[model samples]
Target: MVLYAPLLFLLVLVGVQFALWALAQLGVQYAANHALQTTRVSGGTAAAGRADAAAVLDQVAGQVVVDPRVSVTRNPDTATVAVAGRVPAVVPFLRLQVTTEVSAPTERFRALTLSLTSPSPAGEGDPR
Candidate 1:
């Protein structure tokens, strides 16, 4: 039993590490998506996107993600957000990093003008 015990333990550790990495990846993706959504809306800014990404990371991957970094970029046509972080090492000397990026088209709002003045009767306005 002793010969097989170490192998079993190592397998279990690897599985756990993989699970943690997966969780971190999911969290990072979620953060990026949220940030992208925030920045893609009308009047949204890069700062707002970064803040939203940070908030989501804190809520979703606070424990698993180490040294989390968030970046947001906005242009006239598109908005993008990227989230990156290292996962806490579960096994000895095993380190993993997770990253995700999301982007969407920026919303554009057009101003509409309404004229309140009532038009005169079509036939009465002209002398026939």
Candidate 2:
């Protein structure tokens, strides 16, 4: 029984270490998916699109467990978003970092832009 106790404890420790690493990867995946959603909404624009994308990243950064170590970068031209962060492990001297990137097709808003340029904006002349 005495020998089994030490072996059991070691197994528990290893399990905990793996759990921490998994948690880190999950966090990164969550952030990456969120950032991708923002990029899709922003469409293909230089300023507004990037602004929206950044806002999404900021939201993820603020809410994730590893916010302090989180970093997000978005490339509008390529429609790609990357998220990276590290989660501190419960075990001393152990930590894990995870990163993920997603790319989406560009969305052109030329039709919307041109419509907005019309002399009379929508709902300006009609109440219905």
Q: Which number leads on lDDT?
A: 1
Residues 1-128, model 1: lDDT tens digits:
99999999999999999999999999999999988999999999999999999999999988989999998999999998989999998799998989988888999988999999998888877687
For candidate 1, the per-residue lDDT at 108 reads: 99
Number of clashes found in candidate 1: 0
TM-score of each: 0.84, 0.55
Worst 10 residues of 2 by lDDT: 63-72
Which stretches of model 2 miss by more than 4 angstroms?
Answer: 43-64, 67-77, 110-128
lDDT of 1 at 118: 90
Question: Cα deviation of 26 in candidate 2 (Å)?
Answer: 1.8
Model 1 off-target regions past 4 Å? 111-128
lDDT of each: 0.92, 0.58
Q: Give the clashing residue pairs of candidate 1, or none.
A: none
Residue-pair clashes per candidate, as listed? 0, 0
